[model samples]
Every structure is written in C-alpha cells, then in structure tokens.
Target: MRMFLKLNSLRKPSVHVKAPGVLALRWRLQRCCFCSSPQNESSNISVLRHLTSKIKATGPISVAEYMKEVLANPVSGYYVRNDMLGADGDFITSPEISQIFGELLGIWCVSEWMAAGKPKHFQLVEFGPGRGSLVTDILRVFSQLGALLQSTNLSVHLVEVSPRLSQVQAQNLTGEDSQSARDENEPAYRRGTTATGLPVSWYRRIEDVPVGFSLYLAHEFFDALPIHKFQRTERGWREVMVDIDPDMADRLRFVLIPAPTLASSTLIQADEQRTHVEVCPEGGVIIQKLTNRIAEYGGAALIADYGHDGTKTDTFRGFRGHKLHDPLEAPGTADLTADVDFSYLRRMAGTGVACLGPITQRHFLHNMGISIRLQDSPLCISPGSAAELPQRLYSAAPAPGLRYAHQPEEDGRALQIPRPAEPPAPLLSSGRHKVGEEAPSTTSGGWIQRTGTLAGEELRSTLREGVIGQA
Candidate 1:
C-alpha cells in the first residue's frame, strides 16, 4: 500500500506545538476523515516532504533552495529581530509623524543642495534611515544654513539594512541637541558616548556607498522591497509563493505558481477576474540605480511613499506593534510595505533625471516649507500650541470612508488621478539659472502640465509671432 500511503503522509500532526523550551508531543494521529487537506495544503505538503527527504539522503538540492530549515528556521528572519517602526512598531512613518516631518526634509535638503550647483562634495544620502529621526532632522536643518552649512562638502550617509535599525540610528544620531545646537563645538553628543563627535557612516549596499553627487533620502523607502506577489489567473498571472511545516508545528504557507510574466506581472487579468499583482523588483532596481546616479552626477531624489500613480493591482501589506499583520504571517517577524507606482518611477527616471513631485505626503510637506517651518518654529512661541499650528499646517481630518482606487493608465482608459494640486515649486532656485532653464509652463486653463521646463519657450514663440502680442 505504497508503504501505507507513505507512512500516512509522514505521520506527525496531532497538534499542540509551542517550541522554545519545548512542550510539543501529542501525536496519536489519524487524519483522512474524508481528507480535505488545506491548512495551507497540509503545510505545503509538510514542507515538500522535508525537502525531498533531505535531497534523497543529501544530494540533488537546487530548486533555488532556501527554505532556511523550513521557514526562518528560528531566531526570526523578516528582518531577523524586528522593531519595524512606531506607535509600537510597523506603520507610522512620516518621519515618524513629527518634527514637522524631519524639519521639512531639512528644507528639502537645502533646496536640493542649492539645486546642485553649490555642491562642494555633496552626498547626504538616507535610505531606510528610521530612528535617526530623518537624519537628525536633516542635520538640524543643515546646522541652520551658516553659509550653506559651512560651504557644503558634507558627508552624512546612512543607507541602513537594519542591524536593528542600525543600532537605532546610532542611538538617535548621538542623542540630545534636538534642533538648535548649532555645533559651536557643542561637544559630547551621546551614542555609545562618542562625545558630540558627529561623523557617522553606515551602509548595507547602494553599491556600498562611495559614489558621488548624491543627495537622496527615501522615507518609507519604496514600501519595503521584497514584493513580487501576483494572482490574475485563468491562465495569465499566478505566482505567490511561501510554504512551510515540517510535519506540522506552526504551519505557514502560500503557494500559487504559473505566473512567469504577463508583462512583469503585478497581477491584472481583469474581465478574466483574479487581480492581486504586486511587484517591486528591488524597488525597480534601486530606482534605476538612483536615477542613474542622479543623471550622471547632479543629484536630487526624495521618493516619499503611499502609492498609486497608475497601472493597477497593488499588493503590499504588514504591520506589527500596531497589529494588522500577516505578510506570510511572520517570516522575518513582520513589516513589509507597498504602493509606489510613481508613474513607474517616472518612466524609470529618464530625461536625464528630473521628475520632481509625485507629491502629496500632504502636498510634499506643504510645498517644502511646512508652512514656513511651522510659522518659524518654537512651535510658534508656544502657548497651548498656537491655534493648533495653523490647524496642523492646513487641516486634514475627514477620512472616514475614503475609498479611492481608480488611476491605472497606459491605455487602460482614464486613471492618472492624483492631482489635488500644489507641488510645483522645487525646480531649484537660489541664484543663476540654466539647468534646462527652469521649466514650468501652464499657459493656464487648468491642468496645464509642464513640470520641469517650458514656461517660456522663447517667451511663447514671442507671443505666437505677433511679436510681444501687438505690444
């Protein structure tokens, strides 16, 4: 009887598991009461029968092997030891909701490093730099100007691949000096007590830093990489993998297969139904290698995230301390994100890089001024939070049902939505022009799109040839 149906499918499954310090011995198994299987397909067929019985007694193993002793074998892997974010870990980032979102991204990184022309040795990167409070409130607003923070040449990189949030952003960028410590040699700046000595550098790849002309800051970093989910079906899109269970003990599974590529499946079969696509191929190859290194050494990248700018079907989910959970129910112990079509990251950052404003993290921090850094900070000379700081920089309290989902263009009919308006300023200005002469046309009638440059175009071809419009 095929060895009693392969020893009753490798026995073991009377339930009552709970490792760590042991307490799991209850099997008198019988199953087959009209066997229905499920329980995530009997925990992926007992983890593919204990990896083909350990590759037939240890031998042929490559199915791109990585069951890590069958699902994070132990000591977690979802980021092996989490602390994802706030309000109790996972989901809270907008520079963890305050310090006016890292002091208006430190005045939009000093107006994109004075529009890159003032680059002395610019490289103030920060991808996944949580807990470093938006790079210490963008280096305390680049130490309040002070001649553009002492004529640039600043180096404050911090890529971070979580060694537990890079030791909580090197202990919150050497604690204390919460804005207004203008380094007049204010020594002893905490963190493993290195004394005010700020000169940190940490990386986990972006080709191991080193490259130049950098000024990127990712915030919510492309909704936490690792996505690739799918589900269109009816013979078009499928993929969605993850399976575990060594004779059942904390199961864990999700299997689908078949989706090789319906144009890089982000799952969308439509009239054929089944729609759950969610790709992120390493956040579109590290956002086309950080916009081809800022279009070959120039600079400027912000990329805030929430997602939705077209091409539908998005699958990105997770959450911890705040609850929602189940990104494969704890593979590395929770914290996965998604939603960033950013118009396919602005058609893969082309036109030699210059795609500002996918705007709306409340209109790019209220047009990168954060209502004049909250009416010139000191939270406006406090006194019961000054009229709610201009109603928390222009009101936001009416999201009860808020269901939106429409935008999905590229000939799938209308769907480029997201234009509630107000993210035009940031073509970078602080003196002399010419970077493709500050584009900004909107001949006016509404929806006048021009983005980077076209505001004049030979002064509108000299008023359409009637030279200066009949003077």
Candidate 2:
C-alpha cells in the first residue's frame, strides 16, 4: 500500500493510502476508525466565513441546518464544488466496486416488473446516482431482456441535485458528450436518453419526476441527508448545534442547545440511558415522498445502504480522500453523513405501503446468485478483482442491508424478506469469534451484540420466496 498526503484548510492534513488491490476494504476500515486530528484553518474560506457570519448573526444552528448549508448551499456546498466519487475521490460506492452488483439489482428489478404485470409504460428512477455506474449497469441488463426493452415504455429519471454529477450521469446515460445547461429560472430536469435506448431525464427533486408506475433505486442515498443530533441530558434531550470555537476563533465545534423542542419530545421515551441519537427529517421526508409516490402512482423502491434496522446510535461522520476526518473540522470540504434509521423510514412510510427486509446486502446478493455468478462466469471479472469483491462486500462485518418495499394496491404487489438457510459469520476479527463460527452472545462489559449477520441472510431469503402483507 502506497500512502500519500492530502492537505485541506481545516484539521491536521490526512495521510491517504492508495491500497491497490484492496482499496474497498482499506477505505471502509479507515472510515469506521474515525481517526483524524483536530480542525485547522481552511483554504476555502468562503463557505466557512459565510457560516460564521450566519451563526454570529443568528446564533448556533442545528446539525441538519449546518449540514444543508455546508453540503447543498449552491455556491460553496461540498457536492456543488465537484464530483466526489471513484478511487481518487472521497469514497467509492458498491456500483463502482463491481458491475455484478448492478447486474443483480437489474435482474431483481426485472423480476419485480414481471410480477407487476409488466406495465406498458413505467419509469426507472435513481436517487443520488453517483457517476451513473449503477444505472448504466441496470440499462445494460435491461437491454438483455430483448422485447421487454423495446416493447415496454421504460423511461429513466435520475433524482440528483449536483449539476456536475447530473452532467456525468447524462454522459454515462447518453454516451454523447453532455454538459449541464441548467438555467437559473428553469427546473433542473435535463432531457436525454441512454445508448441502450431508454429515454432519460434528470431532476433536482423526486417530486419533479412524472408520477406513474416507477421503479426507484436509492443506493447509499439516504445516508447523505442532513441529520439532527440530540444528546440525553439530566434536563432531557438537547438538540446539538454547530458553533464557532471561542478559543480557536477559526474552528467549528458542537454545542447543545438546552431548550427542549417538539422534535426531541418523541425521542425522550425511546431511551433514557442512551447517550446520543440522530434524527434525519430530510431522509424521513424523502422516504415519505417515495412511499407516497409508490402508493399513489404504482411502483416499488429498492434501497441499499449501510445502517442498522432500528438501533439508535450516533453514526455522524465525515470522509475526505477515502479517510475518516472530523466531521465538524471542515465545513464543506468533506462529505458529512449518518447511518439511515430504517425503522424510522418504515414508521414514516405512512399507511397503504409495506416495508420489507432491512436485510443485509451480502445475503441479498447471495440469494440473487452472486457466488454462482462469479463461479459460472469467471470471465465477467478478473481473478484480481474477484478476490477483492467478497472482502469489499462483507468487509464491514455485516454489509449494508437491502430493502425491497412497495405498495400492494396492484395485483401480485408485495414486499419480500427472504430467509437464508444459515446466517453469515462476522468477517471482522475483533476478539469476538473466528471465521465460520457462531458469534459470541455478549462482550466483556455485558453489552449484548445484536449482529445483523444471520438476520440479514434470513430476511433476504424470505423476501425472495415469501410475501409479507401490509401492516
């Protein structure tokens, strides 16, 4: 592994290692470590100065408000600055890991479409489509469906806010050289089509997509939404806020607002002993919109991301140059994210829709025939790449879970959480269990380990073959 230094304005400069063969595993491990130095003065002072001025004028801001300003504030937000994907960028996603992941998802979509009576016209939409890798693979697989590609009126819509990324998506989808010509007054839906022969459009919001039968894909999308952090205190839960450090003058710090609000009221009953909890209204709002769209217009969504089903814990962090950095260090230079509370998404999904399998991606892919695909089609991936795939897929102990939930207003419409024959053993060697052995019940401090390994596998299997009715 060859390491190099990447310096930014704030915090101690980080040493990013270029792990050639095992980049995925190395990057993920480093990200989870949360090992980075304190905040330092940044080179990009525009956003920082703007934030400071705002805070000084209006007082401290919520984590969600800070995240939105730093990440989506048109002029200097992180995503607005440039593309942050692939090996040289901040982080690599699963679609970028291997084409196989997308292919499996494409196949899964086809199965669902068939079950949905193969609607004559339907939309294939993706949210936060980074570099268009996943959708590209999906279109390729759809092309293999012969008449299905030609007969069915399948239009592609990408729900992306970044202008730079939208241009990248257009290029990937259309093959023709494309650039975003977004007008200041016009809505951000760029009209185009893929080389695979599907008409495509780009939108800044999900609501912009035309309402109809649709298949929505949101991989690693919800995690990026802004989250509100709350800490349990003697006076009840206090909302976390971002403020300038009085001592450092240039650094940003986390401060709690002592006042209790309506938002913190519900969380107080969840747990009194827990230290911290995150609530992402942005993510919840998106889920509600998606579920409402599916229920009203007729469609289904597949969400794959790294998060616990319902566990309440602080997962807020930052990533830059594929390494973990202090989230509060740099304002808009690094990607700020928190784990998706799938349970919250389920609860907020409202009535008339079913939520299925917050199952592990490992089991979902395994049931989708990932292992067999590698063995049967050896030429699909090189040996070097193949060796790294499993480690990347299972590197984070239990990989990100996959959820396949949809509305049941139409015939044969259902959500599945397949039950795997056996649970997968933990991949990380953390003094708990060896490979292929059952995980230990409790840790040294009497902390019970609620491993999602087997539960994920079983959920995947159940979704594949079984049907769970609407609650």
Candidate 3:
C-alpha cells in the first residue's frame, strides 16, 4: 500500500454501452465505492488542513483514524457533502449500471421474506445506499408481491452518515416526501415516506435501526469503513501510521510504529502468514451487531463488496475522479478504502451463526438468474479491467430464514436463518414455472413488466433455484 503521495488527475465514470434494453457498465464493482465528485475538489481542502492540525497536535494517526476523518468526519468528509455515484461523480454502482442488478437482489430479499414465514412486520435496512437505486428496485418487486404483502407491514431503514447523499436518496426513493428530524437527540436523523406509502427512516448508526424480521443489505458498505494496516516485521507486526512528511511540510506519508500497539498486538492472529495485513475493526463491530441481530430477532444479512477470503495483502488505495489516487494527498477529495476481508468478517461472525461462502459475484448473479437477461444482450467490456472483475468481487450472506438449507451455487457460501422447517418458493414464483412460457400467475407478468426485463419466463426456474436450496 505504498502509494505515491501525490494526487492523480480526476477520474472518469464507468464506460457505458447503449443497446436495446441493455446498459452494460464496464468497471469493477469494488472500485465503485465512494469514488469522487469533481465538484467537491476546492471545498475538500478543509480536511487536509484539519488532518494536518490534528497530526501536529498529537502524533502519527492510525490509518483507520485517517480514513474515518477523510470519509465520514461530521463536517467536511468526502461522503458528507458530495454526490459521488454516477457518470459525473467519481464512480458508478451496480444499481446505477443496470436495473437488473437491483431487481435480482430484490428477488433474493423476497425469497428470504417468504422463507421467514411471512412475518407480519418486515424491515428493509440498507447501509450506505448510494442514490437509493438498489432499494428502489427492491421495493418495486415488493410492490409486485401485492396480495402476499397486503397483510405484512413493510418499512425502510437506512443507515447513512452523509446528509448530502441522504437528500439524494430521499429524492430518488421518496419523491421529496421527506424531512429532517426535529432535534439532534432523535435516533432517526431524517424520515420520509415512499410513493408507495412505505415509511423510510434514516439513522447514523446500525444499532439504532429497529429490530424485527429484517433483511440487511450492505452493498460496498463495509469496504468504506476505516481499516488499520500492519506490516509483518522480524520482531512483530507493526501498525502503519499516517503522519506529516518531515521532508515536505505540505505532504503526508505512511509510517511504521516501531513498537507494538494495541491493534498490532490484538488484531492479528498467531498463525498469520501474510507479510502485510489490513484490519477493519469498525467493520468487525458492525458484523457482530448484524449477526447478533440475526441470531436473536431472526433475520438475514447480505454483504456484497470487493473483498477476498483472506488471500490478498496490499489492497488499501484511493480513487479520485475515477482513477487510482494517493490516499493521503487530498484527503477528502478521493475515496479511501481497502478491500473488505470477508475471512475476517466470517471470523467475527463466530460460531454463534452459520457463515456462508463468499461466492463470486458472477455465480451469485447467475444463481439469481441474471444469465436469463443477458441472453440477447451484447456487452462491450471497458478498460480491459471489467472482464477481469467478475471473479474478484464476491458476496456472502445467510439465508433470510433458518429452515431452507439454502445451499449456495458452486463455491459461494450462504448463511441461513433458522425458522420453522420449510422453505417456500418466492411469492413471485407462486405459479409453477414452465420454461419458455410466462408464469400462469398475472402477478408474475406484472413483476416482469415492473422490472423492465424483456424475458418474462426464462428467469422463473433459475430464480426459484436461487431461493430455498437443498438442505
């Protein structure tokens, strides 16, 4: 992670292609998190100044601290004030890339909801919902569920720190029918209602969201949490620190602490083999909370991000505009993130809950029946890197309920929630799926129309297979 301490040129958005009924975005989904917005460059100078002052007053700060201040510090954080998630912004998300992405994940949610025996109350909790496109696509599927959900009470809860992004999400998800909380003391900082009349509430932290039969989604969210870097040394692992470059007063650089710090001593395992490691304590804490909630209240969590199962070492980097940038140079001007260590997250989940495969994004989507949509679609991969991306980014989650074995496809692992022993098909799949023919149910037709998918029947069988799996 020894990146040059100079800012790179502003980056560009994803390479977009236009074909009938298709938009193929060529970019790595992991690189998509918290890119940058050119509009915020001049205003981002405040964070560098703020970090300089803090480092001078104290000492070299941990990498985690620097990331926290750069990305989510209350005032001048990058995410706090920028619309950084589209063609004009730093990068684009899967949701922004294709409506199909959200629609499939939405189907997964409904599959889990049905597996949960149709709980009277359902909460759709999303963390770091950029532009709200993902959840919007999801709610549309919920709307298509119709009669199945008429008896169920549904609500949306978002955990977001950026007021600027929150407003963008409110506009997209709620049609401007939203308002800020009356006071700072309230747990929900903002609240709104969707066009469909579902309540959407905003919170700054995960624990504040209400507990019940909840479906938790974290798309590229954990990768944004601050991580501490450690380099294996002859004596022991040394924690990486960020400090003002002694040679250049205006610059910042990485430093290695000579002695053992609490993080270096506690976070690493005894049998660790990697020469370099990055640990995200904040991500661990959030996982513990999510799993605890799932174990107690009976729900599921789906986490998708650019990550590894503890294989790679040096992954912490920055993205400005759309290209790799020096993480320390401009501070809040670039997105500072590290690849999420799903292995670390699995360990944090502990034996209290079952941990599933960190499956390939391609496999998960294929299981979700994305191939059914790509049939006639032509893809022009961009930057030559997009072709290399599918195997790199992965997803991990427990099934929405306990009973369904929910075995994963191929190498992907899926966590399953325990409930009464029976996994029913997704509500949309209520009618038998006959390949090459539309589902007999009219709701199925409405679902396909609502999602704007061209293939009406091809997805039914595969999507059902993606749902409850063999025990």
> Highest lDDT: which candidate?
3
Higher-scoring candidate on TM-score, 1 or 3: 3
Q: Clash pairs of candidate 1?
A: 77-332, 78-332, 188-196, 189-196, 266-277, 267-277, 439-452, 439-453
Best by TM-score: 3
State TM-scores per candidate: 0.28, 0.74, 0.75
Poorly placed runs, candidate 3 (over 4 Å)? 1-36, 39-42, 373-471
Cα lDDT tens digits, model 1, 111-195, are: 4444334556767777767667767766765664444458556777677655666677776775442232244333312113223
Residue-level lDDT for 209 in candidate 2:
83
Find the 10 residues in a row with the least total lDDT in model 2: 20-29
Per-residue alpha-carbon lDDT of model 3 for 60-132, expressed as tens digits? 8998999989888878888887777764566555564445566667776665555445567888999999789
lDDT of 2 by residue, 1-471 (tens): 000110001111112311111000000001121112222245247778888899899987788888898889988888877566754455565554466667766766665455345567768888889888888877776776554546777888888889888878788779783435467544545777666557788788887788876777776666778888776666667776787888777777766676776667754446345566788887777877776666555656766555554564666766655454467665777777776666666667755564444434554555565665565454555224555565554433322222222211212112222221222433332211111221111011100011122123432443344221101
The true-structure Cα RMSD of candidate 1 reads: 25.4
**Residue 236 C-alpha lDDT in model 2:** 63
lDDT of each: 0.42, 0.56, 0.61
Comparing 2 and 3 on lDDT, the stronger one: 3
